[model samples]
Target: MIFFDTIGTMAIGSRLRMLSERITEDARQVYELYGVGLKPKWFPVFYVLSQNNEKSITEIAKEIGHSHPSVSKIVREMSKDGIISEEKDKNDGRKNNIKLTSKGKSLALKMENQCFDVKSAVDDILVQTKHNMWNAIGEFEFLLDDKSLLKRVIEQKKKRESYNVEIIPYEEKYKQTFRQLNEEWINHYFKMEEADRKALEHPKEYILDKGGHILIALYKNKAVGVCALIKMNESEYDFELAKMAVSSEAKGKGIGWVLGKAIIEKSRSLNAKKIYLESNTVLTPAINLYQKLGFKKIVGHPTPYERCNIQMELNLG
Candidate 1:
């Protein structure tokens, strides 16, 4: 039924592992037929030492891009079989140097012919296929190396969830909700300072009345995130992004991203050339979000909040 085809990309790892095992089984059979006692798993290390007969386990691991412990285990197994020898380093007692044994050297000579045969067979298969599997695999590895599978999936998840998030302008009805959301996060991280109370407790008086704006993120019709852009002197930063908070329940649903983006657009609409913010390093995720939005870290800024340890500015100019 080709279950993996039905299950789709979610089973990609399983599919690839299955393909690897199939190829390994074929190579194992071929090795036995050719009277070569080498295991397919040992090919990488064996081929490496064939090129450079003497290398430390660390060096081999680096050359092959395998973990040190994994290489160590393989070395131990090959040593047990008398296919490789390990000697204590005279310069560094803690390190062991690896080299192929007499038997392993002879096997390497035989494998050279087998490698040519394998290459010819692989070329035959490639001609029969629509695309070159090696090239596709190389491209896939390059992309995964750039970002990682986990990070790519998280980005997709956020993109999917962002559709359900709605960013709306602030109204008097959302005033208390905004304050509650900010206070929820503040109280959890650090005690609220006087500036926080003045801003959150009376957003209209301290922020809005002075040419500021607020944004609310509605997750499925429920308000769960808020951020404010307080007007600053036009000569300096035109606006300050502050008081951003998202409800714990909606934390992983990309509500924060939507609110931040909306706030930045709001500032741009007000003809702001630059935006500023104050935050603590302890708020790592928040700091990362600001950095992602093109904010650069700055110094020599005074703050009214004791919890503030870092300052950032985004130059829209």
Candidate 2:
């Protein structure tokens, strides 16, 4: 006989039931607002298009983590409802391109605003809960995994963690090495004029002042990379992510991403609202790493020097 009164069975059943009911009710409400014909899952596809307009079906599916067939089905239904349009890909004759129709675009905008309002309301509640919900869910997942399998995975991680990469707070002793790395990086990637190189080599003042911090990544006691965070203003809590350069000898060891994560975590600890970075397109690897870390492209304000560069920002608040 099945034991319904067991703690594990009852807990799992209760949670699953609650989640199913919540999802069903949300889908029903969204369908009623948009139209009885629209599937709630398609809303994410619409939202992605609304942000980055005109993506192929494959791109849409990948971004939304849905299978191509599923996305195709949703697109076909939306096309029939006059909510979206499909076209043949010019470059790839076999692929079908997708974009939002006038009605779909309008609905997407409304949905986006609704999502923002919902997020704001949820944030207020989450502030009090302090992310307890997420912690509970994580604990449940951990419990579900086999103990032996989990121990093996954790042991593998510990073995890899033996590679020691020390990040030291910047000090007078390491200033020369930091400048050397920056100079080498500029010459390698940036076609810096003599004056520009000088400016970087000898800034009027160190990038980080009061309420600012710098870190130098040391690999086996050698200074391999340097990064800085400077407090721009109190209200905005802006910090400049500057002097991020790795030694040529130390390229491609995944050091850059490590330094980036460290800087971001430190900024969060300092209660920063946002972090801004200036970089050039020539540094494709760096730009890719930044995007992977959730930094978005934005317009740059006037700076001390003239370098054709791209500016990126991350909202911490």
Candidate 3:
């Protein structure tokens, strides 16, 4: 139960397996009591071929949503037991069609009558559990067939990373976070200049004391990103939006977007009429975020940092 609760959604495979194992184990015991030799797993292929009379290994696998090798292995065991046989297709020499032997036919007929008991037992369990297990399984299979489990898992990962990110005001505890997150991006793409170091090493002295605001993005209670709006002039609510960085582990999760939005809203609250920023053209994603927030390219007189080739501004009325 602890494992079930702990694993949660991760327990899908195990839970499904347990359901099958429990029911199959009971059915196996039932078969033993009835003195039947067939296994529960063999029913799908055997039952399908009984109706069709002749189906290739590939056809059996496709009918049951099982792999060809798995169907072939079952066919081999059935052949060994003298319960089924294969014949080369007259139209295609490479293809072999499967057929039920006399023994297999006899067993299918006898078990067909007893299958009602198995169905009733399963239905009883479903009733007790307050679930229609057959319908549930059918819907689950239909869902997976419509969109494969792998594609669904991939989309979930991307959505989880990008959609739910949150940004919060910076605190004294996030001193290292501001520095580390910035340093990671700066040092990786370009060398940390003296201007960058002065701000990174002492974020409070360089940014906060200078009438600027710093913001951080948190994912699962951990600060994974930082951004700042540096006040440019003593006269007006003009600010320079800079020092934005998202940790490598949190890059694709839209942390930058969250942090940037927090900075924009903070500037608006501070009566910021205009916001300016400096960046390199190489940082396309970062630039795109600015554009999304109505920041457009503009020519500025001068900049303190050497790496600042492209300048952008947002006019907030």
Candidate 4:
């Protein structure tokens, strides 16, 4: 019986491997149609260029975890193909800077589109092959590892029990809690004068009067996190998911992601065309979570919130 079970498992694994190879081949064909010569090895070069422009060969090599000689050879081939250009750095004569050419930029865009299509196709296939298999696999991996998934589940349960938070439209009673939470955030990170803190804590009456709504996350009937959605104009929506403060006692309880998802759902329900947020780069975990949730980085805006070093945006409509 054990031998038969082992043989069946091996057969299933072999079939899955063959299917994956077929998917890869299909993806390559799609790339070729776009006139882009994409290969597994060339990905490192593109990944470095995507992050920052005009990086030195040494910097690119370091970022991609390749030896300098290997990267130099690849760059030489890429340059000969008219995909990248190399120039001597003016300030550092010994260093060579690599920049993507027009062809390279076009290829990058095409590759992105093709990759998205391939992902969609694979997702559809998996959905059809076995219902809820992805979720089951994810849970299995979580269990096999350091029990991270189980830990997250336990944390979520605790949060649910302690918070029992409800999402509601802006109300006068929430103003005091919002102010208090905002102050707590400022104190936790930014050192500001009493008057300055008070100024920020003072809710903008104009925003409230102009059809703005706030969502507060509460624990034991005490406000813990807050997000605001403001109508920018007749046809536009602006969101300030700020004042998102979780009580120190409730830290590491997955409250942030929950609140973030709730805020996004609320924004969509309100027919928001776009949602914008201001944050600091020092909070890497928060930034990563935002990225995972489909937020994209944007330039800093001219706003009164000077402490907000990072800006992110999401398009709903």
Candidate 5:
């Protein structure tokens, strides 16, 4: 069996590179067949200059989504071949405006016609195949634009490492662990206020007895995170998500996200319509996690803690 076949989807980058090389080879042949005076790689820069008449290397890079250095390298090669010429920018003396030569403009007209035939051939191949590769590539690029491949892979890595983490209901044995986690984060940033002391010191009396719920995340039988859902009496929100904290050791293991999700599910199970939260902008990661859980910033809410500068709510209904 082939090495790529053995690796399956792991060879996606290699497979796409191979496919691109094949298409580029065909482009070279097509250019020769039409007797067009343009290199296969020069078509992009040539086409851009044909339409815009003038552009700087930075503009070309932004338009084609290539790196500045790569575009500069291509521009240098095209200039050496007499396909493009550079003139100093009228407004910016330091920048050079790139435009096509007379010979390049003539080649552009021929390549434009060549493109129509190549497009038709691609369409024919699309019809012959079960799936449309063009549309598939567009959709895949759209997804990558929304969330990069690096971020997606990091999330998967977090999930794999957090598979052993278990979320469990509050118990007497975990009371101290809960306080320790919350206090570690609180004292690291702001002073522990009276409201925080009341809730953390007497969670059973201040939170649990008031119909609130606490959850603890256990990693390898060691408690690493905690969150509380305090049942609210307000008309708009049914619960207030509070007292959420994760151990510094388990920071990137997705413990906060998992604890947050479990708390949200608990609120939903309790027939909550909206869940509210109060936070400070200094806690950027926490705020980001809330947003990822569909929470939106809200205003005009009073808070007992001095550190509460921002409020958000998630509408489950």
Candidate 6:
């Protein structure tokens, strides 16, 4: 019985893999009956080499639609079994060329049209279905040239995950998100003091109203991360990059990277000269990211937050 058989089309991939495995095993049985020591997986490589004279490993691999490593492994096994010969190319000694041995050549001649036999059987069975399996497979292969099935599937998943995340300007609704995201980290490692509360509670009055910019990261239209660039030193176009956080549940989806880029772009747009950030040594992941984005550790900078230990600055000039 097929597990998940009820899912039908949703389980096509598993069904295809299972079907391939079953057909491959049956082909192995056919080879045994013919007294040919061959595995279905080795068919492509062996058949390609049989048709070509002393082809290089890479040439055979590409023609057979297998990786060089996979072809190499099969070649090694075939060479050990005395069915194929491997040697340095006559013209280019650096390249390894492969060819069917006398034994392999004999089998190839005997097995001529044998590969077609299995296909013909499958085709006969598929005749009962309204759909043409060969034509469908050919179309599927054509589509694969544009994009592999695995790649398209992975990209779709990433798109779905990314669709849930969006970075936007600060709003009244997100005042609490900024507080909760930041507080989650602060409360875990250090106590939230008066300075933290004042900024978190009255962001519009204290931060945004002072020509500062704040950004919020939304996941499914809900705030999950937040960061602020507070304008500083009236004469100097310096901005303090502070109060950045990604929610515990939303961490590690490149959300922190997205927020950092947004803040940097906003600071640049505001004609800022430099961005300084203060953090603790324990937040290594955040620090590493900051460093990757050209933030350098600097000494002698004073910070009001008691929890702050490490100071880093990014020169936008």
* Per-candidate TM-score against the hidden true structure: 0.93, 0.46, 0.53, 0.48, 0.81, 0.56
* Clash pairs detected, candidate 3: none
| Candidate 4 root-mean-square deviation in Å | 15.5
lDDT of 5 at 194: 96
Q: Least accurate stretch of 10 residues (summed lDDT) in model 1?
A: 230-239
TM-score of model 2 (CA atoms): 0.46
User: Whole-model lDDT for model 2 versus the true structure?
Assistant: 0.75
Best-matching candidate per TM-score: 1
What ranges in model 2 sit over 4 Å off?
1-162, 191-204, 234-237
Between candidates 1 and 6, the lDDT winner? 1
lDDT of 5 by residue, 70-151 (tens): 8999999999989899999999999999999987887887777788998899999999999899899999999999999889
Q: Residue-wise lDDT of candidate 2 within 1-317, one digit each (tens)? A: 23444556536657677777887677668567644445666777777888876999889989987898998988888889888898888898898788889888777766665667556865776678956665776787686564654566655553454265688788777778877888787777665665445435544354554567878898778888888786676434378787788888877566777788899999898878799877888889889989988899987465554564788889998
Q: Is candidate 3 or candidate 4 better by lDDT?
A: 3
lDDT score, residue 151, model 4? 66
- Off by more than 4 A, model 1: 233-235
TM accuracy, model 3 = 0.53
**Collision count for each candidate, in order:** 0, 0, 0, 0, 0, 0
Residues forming the 10-long window of minimal summed lDDT in candidate 4: 193-202
Better of 3 and 4 by TM-score: 3
Residue 165, model 4: Cα distance from true site in angstroms: 2.3
Question: Which candidate do you rate higher for lDDT, 5 or 6?
Answer: 5
For each candidate in the order shown, give its overall lDDT on alpha carbons. Answer: 0.91, 0.75, 0.85, 0.72, 0.91, 0.85
- Residues 1-317, model 1: lDDT tens digits: 28987999899899889999999999999898788998899989999999985899999999999999999999999989999998888899998899999999999988887889889999999999999999999999999999999998998998899999999989999999999999998999899889999999899999999999988999899999999999886448999999999999887777787888899888888888999999999999999999998999999887898999999999988
